[model samples]
Target chain A: MYQYSNFDHEFVAQRVAQFRAQVARRLDGSLSEEEFKPLRLMNGLYLQLHAYMLRVAIPYGTLNGRQMDQLATIAERWDKDYGHFTTRQNIQFNWPKLEDVPDILQALADVEMHAIQTSGNTIRNVTADHFAGAAADEIADPRPIAELIRQWSTDHPEFQFLPRKFKIAVTGSPHDRAVTQAHDIGLRMTLQDGLRGFEVIVGGGLGRTPMIGKTLSPFVPLEDILPYLEAVVSTYNLLGRRDNKYKARIKITTHEHGIDDIKHRVETKFVKIKPLFTGEDMHILKEIERHFEPPNFKPAKPPVEAISTTSQPPAFRAWLDTNITPHKVPGYAIVSVSLKKPGATPGDASAAQMRALADIARDFGHDELRISNEQNVILPHVHRADLPQVYHALRQADLATANIGLISDIIACPGMDYCALATARSIPVAQQIATRFHALKLEHDIGPLKLKISGCVNACGHHHVGHIGILGLEKAGVESYQITLGGDAGEEAEIGTHAGPGFGADQIVPAIERLILGYLHLRANETESFLEAYRRLGLAPFKALLYPQEKKAA
Target chain B: MSVTPISKVVTANDLRSGEVIYLRFPHSWTPELSKASVITDDDLAQAGLAFAKGQANVVVGAYLSDVVAEIDGPKASHFRDTFRSTGPSNYRHGKQEI
Candidate 1:
């Protein structure tokens, strides 16, 4: 919801101009591919398996109607008819020509958005909780801090070419929807002695070697955060492994040196770094906060007749139950527009659906929309009275699935089906599982389950944090799926444990079904969710259920 | 299972259109794999890769990928390559549009 300043406007225009020139040079054969690759990558362009993928950043997962409309226009005009929203809260256009990227970036710049630092070994887009300002449990809005981080990290000379790609996530609420623990640097907003601060969790990331971030500084005051962060990153830049790309992340650095030694190094670096802070970031934070001011609330509630179980359609009722969550204001609610409709690819929105979402946001929800890390769209300030209209609009656009957090609401990355880095296909397996669950008619009964799949060990789908995680891999040149049990991305977060050996691609869906059905039998009652049930019984039950024949034979 | 020496072809994405293209001999790129230059010999395959890399201005990420020599043309040896040559399994888009 933050609007760009004049400086921001000028800066982005210049960056786009520079990229346009770079694109031209590359096209004219003035620059070699080796020379041009870094330039294109720095601008968020990658040549994937089939085509060039342009990842446009949606900073802190917030955007307005006009921006969304432009995104729709871009999807329709330049690339394919759809754009895939990623777990990083960015939208990826899969088929954009290298020549057209500059124009697309210019289009993005018009909306105060850019793909800068979206790729390459640089500070990436700063992510925040989707329900940042509106969530009832939030102590503060994390977006201002996220915006500050974005500004500081964007084109920062010191950390531009880090040993590895750096990621940072911010969460304002205690409930932890942002999965802060799974980022390179996770900052959970905290209040101590009536002062706003961050519980800085460092080194945690999910990839080839998944790690839960260790708490670096539990309560660094908001004013000192920048310097503290610089120290941490500077320490990492020097000490992080440059020898192997695989072992280059800050997590590996922490793993090698241990958190205590890393902390000592950070503290030593902080002494030199702290004096450089001139309180300019505070002014910037204030400016950013001004842009994020909440809309005036008019009190109203859902119609009594609408809530009547007897009169309402069960599907609509189910949708209301699953998709609606309480807003900070009494009469307002956060409506999650589900992208996971049955067999549809997760997080993929057609241009028409994007336009429809834009219109709905503009007309009904104060022109505010959020892309959740869970790969769903959020109308964060929808009045309770507008629920029926919103739902109607969403239904018309094929956006209403009633499967948010259900079995069918799977978060899957564009795996081998699209990604050059992917080892196996994720989308097909996700579609099959969702379709199977829909056919079984048990998702609503199963309730509040999270299923996530990633193409490879790169945890783009947040598979490590899912209640049930499926990782697709290539084994002997054939697709095999690995299952993990009992991961949760919440206040109480844990990486799911590997259940057993992998299943064949064809075997994955049935294996998931068996696991869920087994979960149903193992649960003390229906109220206990899959994660809760798994916590009670441990991995053995789920593991046995997933591969029953093998378990039985063993 | 024992394997024999298989044919191979060079491929890259066309720079302007971002379409998957196979290297055809005498300096050309084509979406149709059937028209691609099939390298039965290992030395020629490496030569094809070198030639493909030279078409940098027209394409990007050029490399040699395994293919099964067919009467018509070379076919993708791996499923991943097949998906790349074709399009996604979940959707009919890209080269699979026809």
Candidate 2:
């Protein structure tokens, strides 16, 4: 919900003009690929496996109707008929031509958006809690801070060339939805002596070197955030290994140096640099906070028409049970639009579907939408009265899938179909798994289960943190998968444990079914969720299913 | 087979001082560039000036640089270094079309 200031607008426009000239030079043969590559990357364009991929940033997962519409238009006109929304809250176009990327960027700039820092070794799109401003448990909205970080980090002169990509996440509530523990830098807003500050956690990352971040600073005040973050990144930028790409993430540095040493160094740097944050910086933060103020709401109970129906409409009732959450405001409910419809690709929306969502947001919900880390779209404030109309609209657009946070609601990356780095197909595998779960009608029975699939080791799907994690890797000529269990993506976040030997891509669905049945068998009672049961019993039970012959012999 | 060896290399951060050397197909050779055996410091500077004047012509593609010869021959370190660093330069998010 943060609107671009005139400075922000001018910055993006100037960047667009610079890129436009660059693109013209490349096409005119005044510059070759070697010279053009870095310039294009700085603008968020990549020539991937099949075509150019334009990664447009959705800063902190926030977008208004107009922005979403611009994305839809870009998708429809330039690439395929749809765009894939990524887990990082960015959208990727798989087939744009390199020549047209500047025009696409200009289109995005018109909406005050760009692909800056969406890729590369620098700080990525800063993600925050999807329910940041609206959640009942929030002590303060994290977006204003997130926006400030965005401004300071954008086109940062010194930190542009890092050892590896860095991700930062912030959470406003104790019940963390942003998965702060699995980021390079995780800032959880906290209060000390009635003054709001942050608990800075560092070094957490996923990939080959998966780690849960360590708390570097127990409490860092608001004014000191930028300098503090700069110190942390500067330490890593200088110290992190550049010899091997795989070992270059800040997590590796944090792990090798030990958190205490890194903390001590960051503290030293923070002390020396703290004076740079003037009162003017704090004043601007206060001004940015005004943009994020929660919309006005009138107290009204659940609508009589919806409640008066003798029996709950099974579809609407099921949707409400899974997709709606308690809002901080009395009369409003947070509505999550599940992109994980059975048999459809996860995190994909057709242009028409996007338009419908925009309409729903403008009419029934507040003119705001959030893309969740779970790869779902959220209408943050929808009144109870407009629920039916909103539901009907979503249903028409294929957005009203009641599988949010359920078994079929899988977060998957665009595997071989789009991503050049992918070793196997992710979207189709996700589709097959969703179809299998629907066939068994076991998604509802399995309850809230987070399943994540990534095509390769990049872990873009966040397979590292799913309760049921599937990692697609190439073995010989065929696609194969490795499964990990007991992963959870919430306040109590934990990286998953590998169940055992890998399964063939063809065998993955049946393997998932086996895991689900295993969960059912091991449950203490039906009331326990999949994650709860998995946690209570550990991976032993799930591992048993994966290696049944060994279990039988034992 | 007339296989011309060309590898993509980035100029260092300094534009005035650095120059990228790529192979030129005979047709791609502007009459001025066809004469240089190893690009001189002056040639690199002149190329940069030509680019500024919109008179330079360079082609972008997956060129077949003589990989086996480059790796196995005497200038192996030069080839290896060029190949290793032939990626996005200091730009973080997207590539620069310099």
Candidate 3:
């Protein structure tokens, strides 16, 4: 975890104080709603359908036990007893009172966290792979670069009011857990000729219009990343359309002006900015790297035989199979605490659950915690020997769900339930789907499925990248769901293809059931996953299954 | 022939609490949609919205939403408003909690 410097602490505290005064002014009638709206949004406050939502950034999805404890405290004291971890790896308190947001922010700043740049048309939270430093396959920890970007982009004067909100994702592994391809800017850390650099991707986004990012530069040296990124964003700031909010993203800009032209413009800009950076950024990066140094690892053998001989519960074995990921260390494991319990709202963790997780992290997981973009918590450095203890603690908190890459592990946006922009409810549908599948006892059998639901075309759920994507929309005064197939959010990222027509809310769960069941029959073997099968076959088979009545009529 | 006017109600989020509130008769707000003043006349609805918007110190983003007048009160004509009237289906927190 990157420890906040004194300068960082002062900056965050000052911001909180500034926001508190702004809130006071607004409350006292000195600043009108029109004047205060942008200000509030800049500080990550939004008046949603039912209440104000305060989105607090967890920079690069990294935090410690103390920070997590403070988050739990804030949740219990101010907003609802729980918070929603979003796809961007930030946490959103949905029912925050407008008057209490300042206090909430102060609480956040106490733990060296702030909601600054979480919203507004500024560079949002710079997200990296949740398993960045811990994953076995990673070439390097991407957090240092992510932290560097965070430092540069936070309150960057020129980029504050860009054409649209900018998002950046970095991943250190060959496998893309950060969904780098679907961000405004994607940085994949790579080693070439014994020198570290980034494979720079520009203009990938998922919304009304989904586009896989284009490779702007195959490899830009580590030292030149900031300038290169400045070049990209600067080019986007000028070239991105402001005439239409719908087409204002860098994706549309890249689409309209071709990747080559954009690349040329960015290259031109990069040349101008390269010399201006000096080495201050590198110095800061070196200091940041020291803070992220791997924790001292103890020489311990894998607890496979010990656990196997203990007559451990079958549920523990199941959990070990699903929730645990191979860690970089010899006898360590990355335990993903599933927030999506069946019938519960996805990404929501109660204060009690949060505290439990904080404790688990402290006792077993080296005090480091991570929030995955998949809306789960990660105990990045849990020793394999302590797996049983960690599992037991998680079970106590109702966080031990043995469905990591299974069907029940769905990603859903707040949708109409909490989001003002949502046209239909997403949480209920996700809950229903997860519950239905859990009842069937078929999730593990179904195997490695990504079912994501977005309340609307905004695609907050990353529905565009799910193996099975459900997008909810309002049609004829009713909620209608549109399903897509073959979408992937991996090294080979691709936008899902629509499977024709839409289903009513009542029909969606059963429809999904038919689709998955149909897939089981259609797959080449039991080992082949849903996405692999979808790729091997096509949408035609899934379409026939999804809308069987239409197929029968035809 | 005179066309039947669609019933409407003035709605906004409370400035301080951010709870969904509907404008009542004269100059008051209520979280309950049933307690809201259902204006059948378009001009009156606009006026009510304007009035709600003018109460800037108390409310934000005031607008008119369509409603169907029943014997007891006005019911939200749209699902979105219905959600605002009640609360999110996933949780019993906002208006539903009250």
Candidate 4:
């Protein structure tokens, strides 16, 4: 982990002190709610439906065991004894009081963390591929560049108040785990002519209007990448719509201005800003690279034969099949601890669960942990020999669900349950779907399906990119859900196309079960995933199965 | 003939604690929506909101929430208002715990 410098420590301390004073003023009637709203938002405090929600940024989704422990402490001591990990790879503490937020910020600062830019119209947490350095397919670790961007965009005077909140995602591998194509700015590290550069994708996002980003540049030289980003964001800052809040994103700007027009303007701006970056960023990256050096691997093979010979638990076998992935280093496996326990709230970790995970990171995981965008925790470097012990610990904590990419492994936003903007409840619906599927014991047979549920059109759950997407909406003052199919968040990314009418909240889970059951019958074999079946057969068969009664009525 | 408006109640989050609170009477708040006084007229609803606004020292985001007047008390007209009464269905916290 990159340790915070004295300058970084002092900067966060000063910010906390300033926000404490602001909170005091707001409470004393010195600052009106209207005035306090923006200030609170700047510090990542949102006035949610039930209480104050504090969104703390986990920069590039990287954390050490101590930081995880501190987060657990914050959850237990201040807010409710739980935290929600968001699709942006940040953690949100709901049910916090306004008076307690300053104290909470101080606790976060003690651990070199802050809630800064996790909300408001600022460059949010710069996310990276969770398995950045550990994955075998990656060319190089993407965190060094991501950390550099985090430093640059943290209260950058120029980009602080854009037309709307901007998001940036980075991935070093050809396999797009970061969902690079669905970001405001997506950077894919590529090698061209023996020189490393990025394939820049611009103006992709999911909200009221979903769009797949257009290629801004095939490759920009590594040295000039920052200048290129500045040019792109600057061009967007100038031309993005300010009149309509809904249309204020860079995606709309690119849509309205056309990619060619936007590209020409950005390149024109790039020429002017290219000279300002004077290799300081490269030096910072080298310094950051020192912190992310690979862990010394023990030369020991996993006891594969012994485990296979012994009567292993069916649940453990199921867990190994779904949750474990190949590591770049031999004898090591990346463990994805499922936060989506059956019938529980997705992405929520209790204080005890957090503590247990922290202990596991300290003991088994080289003190490094990652929060994946899929709302699960990643033990990035666990030894294969230690899997049984890790699994035992996780089972005790109720974090072992044995479902990684199955139907039960759903990504859901804190909809009307906690979010003020949500029109319907996402947690209950996700629970219903997961519990129902688990009861059926069909998830293992289903294989590699990504289901995402968003409470509203905000798409915070990354519902726009799920293989099967469920969006909750309010129709006729009752909770209604709309389903979409054929969405894929991969190297070849596409926004999901919506299926017909919205279903009642009660009708959605059974409808999804019907779609999946139809998919099984429609598939040539079990190896073909849900997305593959949907693509091969098209929506006609699935729709026919989903609403056979409706077809009969017609 | 004059038409009577739907019933309404003034509610806001307490400034100190973020608990959802309803205006039961002048300068008083209760967690129970049933204890809230309902205004059947638009002018009275506006007046109730203004009265709640004067108590800004203890509250924020004071506004009138639509409700239906029942024999027992005022009931929420929308599911959102119902959420304020029972808290989130996912967990037993806030007003739901009470």
Candidate 5:
């Protein structure tokens, strides 16, 4: 984890003090609601459907045990004893009173965390692959670059108010765990002639107009990333539309002016600015990289007798198979703690569960934790020898669900249930689908599947990237859900295709059941995943499954 | 022919606590929808909304929400308002806890 320097500490403290004064002014009637709204949003406080929600940034989704413990303390003290980890790899405290938000932000600052840039039109928190440093196939650790971007973009005066909110994601791995394709700017680290650089993709977004980002440059050397990025954002800042909020994102900007035109503009800008960078950014990057040095690894192996198939419970074996990922180190593993427990809210963790995870990270693994974009917690470097103990502790904490990439592991946004922007409730729909699948005991058999639900077209849940995507909308005062199939957020990213018509809230679960069970019969074999089957067979068969009556009539 | 006006109530979030609040008759706010003043008259509803918006120190984002007036009180016409009146379906927090 990157420790906060004196400057960083002073900056955060100053922000907290300013926000505290702003809150006091609002309460005392000196600042009107119109004046206070932008101020509050800038600090990541939102008056949602029910109460004020505070979104705290976990930059690059990295935190240590003490920080996690402090998050638990804040949740218990001021919030509703639980925090909702969002798709953006940030945590939101839903029930915080407006008066206590400044205090909550101060609590966050104490642990070197803040809600700054988690909202507003300013560049939001920079995200990277959750398994950045630990993943086996990574070209390099992406977090140092991500941290550098965070530092540069934090209060960059020129880029403070873009036409719309901008997001950037970086991945060191070719597998694309960070959904790079669906960001305003996506940096995939690559090597050319033994030199490290990034394949810069621009204009990809998942909201109303879903687009897979186009590559602006095949590769920009690591030394020039900052100036290159400045050019890209600067181009968008100048050209992006302000006439309509709906079409203000870089995706639309790049779309209106073709990728070639945008590329030309970016290159032209890059050429102008490249000369101004006198290597200070590189120096800062070097300093940031020092904080992210890998933890010391001990050579060890899992106790054969303890983890042997005959002695271990099937649940433990299942957990190992699903929740664990191979680490770069030989005797270590990446443990994904599932926040999507069966029938529960998808990404919510109670204060006790957060503490339990912190303890496990401090004791069994390295004193580090990661919040994945998939809305799961990661113990990024757990020794294989400590698997049994970690599994037992997780089971005690109710975090040991053996459904990492299964049907029950759904990503859902805070729909009408909690979000002011949502037209329909997504949580209840996700809960029903997960509960239904769990009851059938077919999730493992279903194989690796991504079922994502967004409350609205905002696509906060990344529904456009799911293998099976459900989008909820309001039609004539009734909640309706439309399903999309064959979406993938990996190396070969593609937007999902809609499967004709929509289902009511009451009918969506059974509609999904019909599709999945239909898929079981339609697949070439059990090994063929839902996405594979959908690809081979196309939408005709799946559309029939969802609407059998229409097929019967046809 | 005169069209039947949609019965509505003035709604906003309490500025201090950020709780969903409904404006009652004269000048008061309650968290309960049933306690809210349902105005069937269009002009009166707009006046209620204006009054709610004017109380900026106590409330934020005040607007009129469609409702159906029953013998007991007002029932939310839209599901979104019903959610605001009750709470999120996922948890028994907010107004639903009471």
Candidate 6:
């Protein structure tokens, strides 16, 4: 809900115009591919395995009906008739002509959107809780700060070429929905001394090397946020390893030098930079706050006509249990549209579906839309009175599959479909697993389960945080998968532990089914979720089912 | 090794409207490099920045270097260049000094 000021609008417009000319020059043989590569990356465009991929930032995963419609238009007109949402709260178009990219960017600017900083070594898209302002438990909206950071980091010359891609996440609530512990910089808004401040966690990341972040500053005052962040990032920029791309991330730096040492350095830097924080910055933050102020909210009781009377409308119950969450307002609910439907590509929405969702946002919802980190769409403020109508509309568009937090609600990257770095196909595997679980009707019976699949170590699929994580790899020209158990993406989050050995692509689906059966067999009745059972029973029982011969041999 | 097929890629910040010939593979473009072209300065430097003229079109324009057999629907091929085709073969970063 962050609105752009006239200055912000003009800045974005000027940028669009500047890039257009640059594109023209390159096509006219004035700029070579080498010369244009980094420039293009800054704009979140990548040439992957099949076509150009444009990653549009959903800064803190916030959008409105108009923005959604703009995305639909881009999908329909510029490239393929589909758009793929990503784990970083961004959307990617898998197929677009290089010649049309500038025009596509121009179109985005028309709607006050851009693909800026969605890629490259710069401060990538700043992500936060998708249910930021609307969540019932949030202390305050994180977007105002997220938007402030977006403005501060936009075209920021100082940190443009960092040692590696830097990510920042913000969570306003005690329950970290933004996955704060796994970002380069994680800001948790908390109350300190009866004043709102932040618990700054540093150097958390997932990829080839997974690390849980460390507390850099236990409590940083609200006024000192920008300066403090600048200190942290610039310090890392100076000290972070530049020799290896794999090791250059601040996570590695934090790991190598120790968080205490890093914190000391950042504190020293913050002291030096603290004076630069003028009232102007505070004024800007206040101005941005105006854009994010909750819309004129009317108090209403829960709609009497609608209540979840069905304790066992499996689909409805599943949705209520997983997809819908308690809103901050009465009689309103935040609806999460799961993209993990069987046989459907993760995070992909067709142009028509986008249009439908846009219409839904305008009519039933508060014209507010959010792209979730789990590769789903969100109707942030839907009235209880409009639930049935919204459900029916979503059902018509194939968006009403109510498996939100079940195993079917998987997070998968584009994998071999679009990413040049992918070793094997991930989306297909996610689809197969979802379809199988749906067919078995084991989703609800299994209780809340998160099955995340990533094409490679790059945790775009968010496999690092799933209750059951599947990582796709290539071995000798064949696709193979490794499974990890006990990962969680929520407040009590933990990265999963790998199961014994890898399974061939052919063996993965049946292997998953076997794992589920093992769960059912070992579970202490149906009351426990998959994560609880896994935590209680440990990997021994699941390993026994996966490799009986290996245990027998042992 | 057989010569791997290659395609041209351009960022959304580098594309313009109107009739423009571009190529695509079955799912995504090639690696960071490999038969890629900026074709325009904007395409090269458009990443992490906003589009100038249009809604930001990230695209690839290439003719199939080799005749690719279609394995999926529409005009796309499963053929890919090997790891040898890493980085921009004909391009380098920072070629455009400020």
* CA RMSD (A), model 1: 1.6
Residue-wise C-alpha lDDT for candidate 6, range A1-554, written one tens digit per residue: 77777887898888777777777776776776667778878788787754567899989999998999999999989866889899999999876776788888888888888999888889988999989889999999999999999998988999888999999999999988889999999999999878988999998888989887888988998898999999999999999999999999999999999988998899999999999887677788888898887866656766533557664355565566677888898878899987767778878898999999999999988788998888899998988767767887898888988878788888888887557798777877888898898899888889888889998998877788898899998876577899888888776768889887889978899999988988898999898888999899898898888877787899
lDDT leader: 5
TM-score of chain A of each: 0.98, 0.97, 0.99, 0.98, 0.99, 0.97
The collision pairs in model 5 are none
Evaluate candidate 6 and give its CAPRI docking class based on DockQ: incorrect
- Model 6 has a DockQ score of 0.06
What candidate 5 gets wrong by more than 4 Å, as runs, is A301-308, B1-4
- Per-model DockQ against the true two-chain complex: 0.79, 0.06, 0.92, 0.82, 0.91, 0.06
Residues B27-98, candidate 2: write the lDDT tens digits. 232211112123324455445434433323332322122222233331212322232223222112122223
Interface root-mean-square deviation of model 2 in angstroms is 13.3
Model 5, residue A115: displacement in angstroms?
Answer: 0.4
**Candidate 5: interface RMSD in Å?**
0.6
User: After superposition, which runs of candidate 3 have C-alpha atoms over 4 Å from their true positions?
Assistant: A301-305, A308-310, B1-3
DockQ of 4: 0.82
lDDT of candidate 1 over A395-450, digit per residue (tens): 99999889888988899999998898999999999999999989999988898899
Residue A90 in candidate 1, Cα distance off native in Å: 0.4
Worst lDDT run of 10 residues, candidate 5 chain A, spans: A301-310
lDDT tens readout by residue for model 3, A1-554:
78788889999899889989999999999999999999999999988999999999999999999999999999999978999999999999998888888899888888889999988898999999999899999999999999999999998999999999999999999999999999999999999999999999988999999999999999999999999999999999998999999999999999999999999999999999999999889999999999999998777766545764548899999998899898998888899999989999999999999999999999999999999999999999988899899999999999999999889899999999989999999999999999999999998889999999999999999999999999999999999999989999998999999998889999999999999899999999999999999999988988999888887798
Reference-based lDDT, residue A12, model 1: 95
Model 5 residue B93 lDDT? 86
